[model samples]
Target: MTKPSRTYRSELRTEQAAATRRRILEAAGACFAESGYGRTTQAAIAARAGVSVESVKAQGPKRDLLLAAFEQAFTGQEGRQPLAEQDQLAAAFAIENDDAFLDTGLEFMAAANRRAYALWRALTSAADSDAEIAPVLDGILARRRKDIESAVGLIQRRGLLAAGVRVRRRVAAELSFLLSPEGYQQLVAESGRSHREYLDWIRSMVRATLERMEP
Candidate 1:
């Protein structure tokens, strides 16, 4: 049998590193969800990931791990990317029809909220006492607000917004509140609503709000 080339070996190493990083992030997320951020340590994450403590440390500190885990949860991926950079949102915005836009946009938001809701709860609960987490929380909120505003801007530009809803600020705020993780937790997690039911409810609410404001 022929041996693999150096390039192939290098690619293999890169893939292995990525896999390890993903495992560490997954373990950290589980630890945070179960124990809360205050109680979750690097050592705990290391053990949960079945890697050495030094391996976890090489990834970064606990704060970095928390941020990475949250990113993975929200994006359903390992690497960090801005919300505005998401191709799904861009595709949704490109959809000219209001119904299509709302459907696709709500679908994306609901999926992300479903994946991240538990970790979001853990982070919010921990942020109350952990000052280190406040910055990450703030950054996430700011990005969410920006994304809401961007979506609203697209709708307004398409002349799909309701006539009475002239204020972008108010519309953005309402959408943000409706699409928040807390709302998801309440409806889907606590109220026993299926993911499909929750998404349909959001779609209905968004359509009604937009129709009522349609100029």
Candidate 2:
């Protein structure tokens, strides 16, 4: 049997490294969601990933791991790009019909909230005690607010906002609060609303907010 070439060996190593990194990120996300940031240690993450502590350290510190997990959850990948820079958000904005835009937006938000709710709650709980985590949580909220504002802007540009709702910022703020993780947790987790029911509520609220402006 012929041995593999050096290039093949190098490619195999690269694939193995990517797999290791993916495992570490998945393990870290589960750890953070289950244990919160303060209680989740690098050693614990390594154990969860089935890798050595040295390998986890080589990837990055615990903080970087947490941030990477958040990025992965939100953007469906681990990258430094902002949420607005993503094609998903751009596609959402490109939606022309008012009803279609709102439906698509709610669907996307519901999916995201389902994936990240536990992780976000864990981070928010950790933020109260961990100063380092507080800023990261704040940054996440800031980005979410910006995303909501952008959506609201698109709605307004399409003349889909209600006649009485003149202030775009206020409308964005209200929509953001309604679509927030906390709201999702309260309605879905605490109040026991089904995901479809919650999304329907969102649809109703959004439609009520813009009913007068639908052309």
- Best candidate, TM-score: 1
Error of 2 at 90 (Å): 2.6
Which lDDT tens digits does candidate 2 get at residues 98-192?
Answer: 66767877887887787777778877787788788789878878877777777777777788764334566778888888888888889998899
* Candidate 2 steric clashes: 0
Residue-by-residue lDDT tens digits, candidate 1, 1-215: 99999999999999999999999999999898788888899999999999999999999988778878988988778664566577787788778777787788889899999988889988888778778888778887888887787778778878787423446667888899888999999999999999999999998887777676665
- Report lDDT (Cα) of residue 140, candidate 1: 78
Report residue 116 deviation for candidate 1 (angstroms): 0.5
Worst 10 residues of 1 by lDDT: 161-170
What's the lDDT for all of these models? 0.84, 0.80
Flag regions of model 1 displaced more than 4 Å: 1-5, 78-80, 162-166
Q: Which stretches of candidate 2 lie over 4 Å from their true place?
A: 1-15, 162-166, 212-215
